[model samples]
Target: MSGAIIMLNAYFSPSDLAHVKICPSAKWSPKGEIVAGINGKGSEPDQFDTPYDIFIDEYNNMFVADSLNHRIQKWPPGSTKGATVGSMARPLVGIPYPTKIFVDSEESVYALDYGHDENNNSIVKWRRGLGNNGTLVINEGIAIGGLCGDMDGNLYISDYDKNEILKWSPGSTKGILMAGGKGRGKALIQFDGPRELYVDGTHNIYVNDEQNYRVQKWRPDHINAATVAGGIKCLNDFAVDMDGNVYTVDSCNSIVQKWSPHSSTPITVVNGDPSGIYAISFDTYGNMFLCEGNENRIRKYSIIYNDC
Candidate 1:
């Protein structure tokens, strides 16, 4: 099972590629077409003048998490280029480094904002229509910052340093530790520095067990843990296809491995580029989007099926 999704720097021209820098993460809208990502220009630690994660909304509105700039930016539909959108631009809401972001079906935006030097990360929520009145859903309390909302509207977060997944109901204020502990694999059910999180239609939560080198699935109704995919060397992120096939970024191996439900063997689809894949998502059209952290760009791939 092999596939490829070639991606171009949508923000630049082929002739200017030599002079442009790229970002590290990418995601597709629920409807696909528009691809969003966090971009940082230049080399080294301080060149990130406009370090932001942006996505085009359902209405083609671009929402940007202007991280270091401490703001949520917008680019309304039809704006070919610029940082502002829909009349309101320039730091709509104030904050710190807004790194990871997720938008729920209700149009509410959830952001994982990096905290102050002594504070933990924060999970902030921007309620649609409420505008600037949006509140901080979760405080500066999590270890790392990845967010996902389930079908039922429940939020699942990855607490990196704690090596666990946290869950919160639709309107709840506190988060409950879903899996893992403070230490690496503290118990048989725990993991080692879990990163991104995904919840399926059946409400099964999948955690990218980063340092542990595997993916763990936990049912909303079950407390026991199950290794849906394993034996991966240096795993970082993954996505579950509509048919339940698991596609993962086997980083150290420089390939995206797909595993059928409960299968022990994996099918490698890309190879020879050991970049840290930080994110993955499948579009409604069945095409897949991947975030090659070190590749500094997003790639799209279509899965062609052959009758055996």
Candidate 2:
């Protein structure tokens, strides 16, 4: 049996994704451009209260998990206004607080409705038609933190309540334990509070151990997860480039840093923001998008330096 590391993600593989300008050695512009949200808090089409996650689709459209607003907003390229594309406030779905989101190739939006009526935590999918009464992918007593899908359509979910990761095959009613079933701890086999995970092509899981302030990579069928990046200050979201370089936002200090596989410490990427950057993502052009939670703005930082 040949055992080799397999690198993969929902979007692209590690080996083939570097040409778009996302590299560990690259530097982003010090200033950020307002791509979404009007620098104010409101329920208007151009405003946001607390945006938690950012998902960039294949078409370069940005999908935001508007946590406080309890909806998902889809903003097309060069658009200042966004459409309310997903929600859990329908008469049938009850009131919910959505926290994380992902957009598939078909542009369907999937959000983790963290709490609905205090007990109905679920993953809801809003199809292309954009309806409030979205289809429930998983529900009933689950405390969801984050979720993502693989090429095979399998869903990987992080359960904060159980401190574990579960994999739900397409059409399956239940999720099988994939990692971190030993309760919450700092050990490699445990998750203090897991959030925002991505499944690579070779089945390795890159998970954000939020409370632990680090990123851990769980290889396929393995019990221990190796820390990819550590010593972060309140890391809320992260993105890995095709070269396996990890980019993270220090949510508390408003700093951004990059972790290369060859370095023990991280290189500061950005600093001096509004001090509440909650999420991060990279566009096809290698520009950076950050969700400023306190400022209610999606800030875009273009690539200012590239070694390649």
Candidate 3:
């Protein structure tokens, strides 16, 4: 109960993990299972190309930003063949190479354009059955890298170029700075290559300070941020559990690391592998889903707890 547990928005402590575990996972867990996509990469309905991020709703419905395919695919509770929900053909120019996604309670999906096109650096919103297109909301962000939303309907975006995170309220055109605008540095107030943000229940902001090789937590106090985890590299994605433990994606080495509160280094939750894991999410049932960018698929792992 010292550090945060793994996966998604669902929080778990070390004691509650006996119920569900990622089978055949890493050293802590068992192994992994491929829940979505296929053996090889393709553009078919059941395939993904450079799948970047994932958002799993309470109902276990998954929304994926199939980056290279130039579309957002929705996979229902038990379906492998996903339906194209967000695309490039339509009312909006469309999300070209969506890198990240966030799904609000209203089922409205926000897709962040990876800035593949200078004119298309935008975030598109798509609701259920919105026909193949989405409405462009925030456009031309300065190298938007990561995005997430809170219960208050506020959107948090990490601007890589500006080295800061901005908060956007519902229907608001302008964003207020939340953290790290003082240029990139090792200072707690500064952020270098900030990416993969998360908003907890209390509206706390968790940021992966990539260049600095650490994760910082910004509370509502409006004071200096705290370094939750340090001495890691290429934190492509991470999640904070109910216990405040931080789990991060050490992408450069192809592993997932679990960092407890106030820890200097992290324990490797996942072991060595060759695939490129860009993003990851965990479900309430202890299923771990990760976007294997190099493999072009989303794989799930069930943690096995033996006599724990």
Candidate 4:
């Protein structure tokens, strides 16, 4: 097959929201359309309130951590409205404040609550289909900045306050310090405000060192982490695709960069004017989705590569 690149532009809303546009490229592959949420801001099911994070499952369903509303919304592909899967105002039981969400292979939903009260700020797990209430999994004293799971169901959390990453086994009471447990610093073994993390199939952990404006990768038995990419204006969130390619959003520069494994430099995937990207994720089909928090919209980008 011959390789060719195509660029297409599509407008979402017919009104002022027309500013919300999808620019698709063959190499970068953003499907020229708005997959979920509306362009303008609102609290309705079709809208979002400063959506902090997003996770797309194997079935193309999008689960959003609607931070301001304090709820988790499940948006099926092509649907205008989403179902409130988890919320702080659930009738009998609910999480007080939910900041991030992760969906495992079994479709289990894991949410990180930032803690509104003394007993808050923990990790909650809700089994597949049991969306009403969640069970507390990890309840540490300090708040958790990021949460991710590996192939073996092991959980990894980034404690911003402690400046470390904790690894918790399936049923363990407490987590073992995997990296950066020692105070905040710019050393190889230390981290300053580690935010989001991603674990690949081989259990390699990749963390966004938010304060340091860099991304670090740690192996299973490594004592220190190697910097993969850095020098971005502001690093907010990141995602790793099946091929081990790393994608991260730089909020300050308003662009997204793609880095190959062990590569120090990155290929600018999403570049140009300020978009205010708060989060980034990939679907099963390798499509990239960005959460434009300031614009209050979710944009989709489909990647297509043809081997000639």
Q: Which candidate do you rate higher for lDDT, 2 or 4?
A: 2
Candidate 4 on 213-289: residue-level lDDT in tens? 88898888999898887876488898765555667898988788878765567788777643788888766555678
What is the per-residue lDDT of model 1 for residues 187-222, given as tens digits with 9 covering 90 to 100? Answer: 458877777677776777777777767788888667
User: Candidate 1's C-alpha lDDT?
Assistant: 0.55
Clash pairs, candidate 1, are 5-300, 74-85, 75-85, 76-85
Output the better candidate (1/4) by lDDT: 4
Query: In candidate 3, what residue range of length 10 has the lowest lDDT sum?
Result: 1-10
Runs with alpha carbons beyond 4 Å of true place in candidate 3: 1-29, 116-120, 306-308
Best TM-score among the predictions, by candidate number:
2
Best-to-worst ranking by TM-score: 2, 3, 4, 1
TM-score of 1: 0.68
- How close is every model to the real structure, measured as TM-score? 0.68, 0.90, 0.86, 0.85
Instruction: Name the weakest run of 10 consecutive residues (lDDT summed) in model 1.
Output: 9-18
Output the number of the lDDT-best candidate. 2
Candidates, ranked, lDDT: 2, 3, 4, 1
Worst 10 residues of 2 by lDDT: 1-10
Cα misplacement distance, residue 49 of candidate 3 (Å): 1.2
